[model samples]
Target: MFLRNQWYVAAWDYEVDRQPIARTICGEPIVLYRRFDRTLVAMRDACPHRLLPLSMGLKEGDNLRCRYHGLLLDSHGTALEMPHGERVTKHLCARTYPIVERHRFAWIWIGDAELADPALIPDFWPCSHPAWRFDGGYYHIKCDYRLAIDNLMDLTHETYVHQGSIGQPEILAAPIDTRVEDESVFVTRWMPDIDPPPFWRDALKRDGRVDRWQICRFIAPSSVIIDVGVAPVEAGATVENHDQGVRGFVIDALTPESATTSHYFWGMARNFDIDDAGFTARFKAQQGGVFLEDVDVLEAQQRSIEANPDMALRVFAIDVGGTRARQVIDKKLKAQGAAAS
Candidate 1:
């Protein structure tokens, strides 16, 4: 909830082609559209003239023609044409945001203009490499964005909450190590002498034998990247000669729309072949359902917290990562006088 001066994924690259799409990030309504040249642009959705939503407007060539007064806004959010005049006036323009399209997603900076740095933005797995494949999309959640981040940082809950999906019983007893650096927190757990789950059996080519496993990663205010690796098993354990084992990464970006609402944008990347349409579709569907399950629980938790704001909560060692995340958020919010904690 305190994620200001950060870049958040706004929409999938394919979602804003040739059409005006409206979204809210950090409580600010925004509109995104592409020029005829396919370059993407983003601006406050409201028209500067009358405060009307510009997303309700139309795309005329390279400009967005406001539906209210037919004002033409260029890619830079400069008012190119007003019904009453011909010269472009800087005073009659919407608040523009710096936008960039990369890795099949559109990213927007929602903070102080001077603090916008693309280099500081978290990098997506598949988006950064050609060896990986990704599925891009998002989900609207009823819970606050902080809750979504807390859920991701705490893997211990998966054993019970996601028992049917990526969860494993052995992970519950595994010891976790936590670390914090530069406002980012990371947690790592190693599970040895454990067999691969049914879903990962094919991917890892395991043969009912014990092997080293690792889940380690970093999480910032509204984003995370988890790297999961499995040690190589003996040969002839499964079909033909598949690579020793597989390593996969899960990357997510959470954007807060308001105190009680958020958008979860996530994707998975693996070293294995996910190029086939069948495999991609199956994986996306499976993971998507697991995310929905998380949404249900988090939304309920947010409601309970909202109902009892003064309730004291207890924290265990397993909650270290989540607690640290909240601390960083609280500190940032307090510095900016934003609501947090």
Candidate 2:
């Protein structure tokens, strides 16, 4: 198990309301509930008083009432009242985890409490900008989280793996540049003078003129934001004009449920001024299918790794981003170990 000290997505902010939701992160079961003031609280799911799952209890105003013994727990996880005892006071409290809600997701800190900082959380650019239309969803995959991270960092696979959906075969041999910066890896590819992919074909034609294409970015350990735009194609020379269309931004994160299980959270934004609910839902579904395809391959790879733990895998130059990501993870885990010492 890796002691990743970064923000991990716990649940959708809207998923936790009046009711208490139970979630397990890094093998720790936590129960999350919202106070009347709208602040969220997370405590160990087990009640210290009777060792019962607190999630089985009820929410009463600002406290959670244990169903077995009717004990009321406050936002601080302190045992405020016990129906049978008058001597019990604030001394009894469950373990509380630091939590923050941002970008439509709840982030939980499973590491050292002092290191938990809301400001340190990664920014989901699309979620914060009003000019972008955002769509988000989740998926449960039977794969090691590292595999998912590797898959995202390696974009070359898209040409073959996602050929029908999001990939362009014409750009299969495009040159790619890779770089690593402070726990993040970036991969960029520039494709010029190519026919627009199906999704961009219609959007690229402006007043009967086709445009040039550029796919510029990919960030890691688990996020990618590509800027694709078309300009007029004339006499083998690119003419700068208004963008045919733009794929606003895409942000994705994979949270590990265990050594061989993960939860994927993804969000996409578009610059176009289209916000019909039905259209958004359909788009989300289409993007979700693409994610499912990745999940299938990742899970299979994970299973193969499990079956042959000692097998050495060969890597090519195209795996530069993935190699960098693994190095970052190794460095973080090593630093965590050194700090513990």
Candidate 3:
């Protein structure tokens, strides 16, 4: 079972156009498109008659026409025109979903549309904040979304997975503190006065001893924002507030497409180089490369988990952060189940 009545990102705001696109979220196939007025719409992907995927239909004005028989549906999923001019009734409509475009993302509520409050959407302010430049790409990984959550919550794997780009030996030695507050989980690591990694050195534009930090915050259901950056040793940047340094918030939102497949939206919102479009493009490319490494590891790990079904996964000291996040998910899921019953 998955968390319901919560906002799950469906696509980047830019991904939706007048042409319909099909996406599966929480095992529900959905079709998304922008109306003539540029407002977005999300609805069940199937046509009510014969159950043909509406995403394969043609866009006519703000409505969609099923390619197979030309059954037309308005943006609200109401059947407007029946094929062969047959009389259309209100009961011929398709189901629609609640969608909101915010912080450069389009979010859809998976259940209980009446309970899908816009206020419940995850706070991704850094992506929309005027002071930051944000850009990244998406990946469809063949693995359970929870595995991706675990990978993000536990950064120890970076020592090997991303060693060529952003990894550093100092990260392995840094003491990690995992804490839980309500439904949120925080795993913070502080590496003070250590040699900067190659990525940090390039971003800082100078090589010297620096204080680096990685604060991985998990917002329940499936979102992880990693606060990472470095500052000169003399800068005196503390873990509480680190604006004195060049910092970036690594934005991640995982939407489950199935029990073993996920839609991974990843990006970096940086306070520095806000005006450098070229830098943003270059960095986005580099970041995409780094995440591809993770995709490979995660896909392999998923296959391994399936092959060794008798062997249950184990948790250790390094998994505390992910463990806490899972606990929050389990609690919420239980509450939702009870409410439904």
Candidate No. with top lDDT: 3
C-alpha displacement of 83 in model 3, angstroms? 1.7
Q: By TM-score, highest first, what's the ranking?
A: 3, 1, 2
Residue 329, candidate 2: how far off, in angstroms? Answer: 1.1
List where candidate 2 sits over 4 angstroms from the true fold: 202-244
Instruction: Kindly report which residue stretches of model 3 are placed more than 4 angstroms away from their true locations once superposed.
Output: none
lDDT of each prediction vs. the true structure?
A: 0.77, 0.72, 0.94
Residue range with the least summed lDDT across 10 consecutive positions in model 1? 234-243
In terms of lDDT, model 3 sits at 0.94
Q: Model 3, 86-181: lDDT tens per residue?
A: 998878898999999999999999998888899989899999999999998899999999999999999999989999888988788889998898
Candidate 1: regions farther than 4 A off: 84-89, 210-216, 232-244, 337-341
Tens digits of lDDT, candidate 1, 250-337: 7778888989998888777777876777887888788888888888899999889889989955788888877888888787777777
Better of 1 and 3 by TM-score: 3
Best by TM-score: 3
Each candidate's number of clashing pairs is 0, 2, 0
Q: Rank the candidates by lDDT, best first.
A: 3, 1, 2
TM-score of every candidate relative to the true structure: 0.90, 0.87, 0.99
Q: Give the per-residue Cα lDDT of candidate 3 at 284.
A: 93
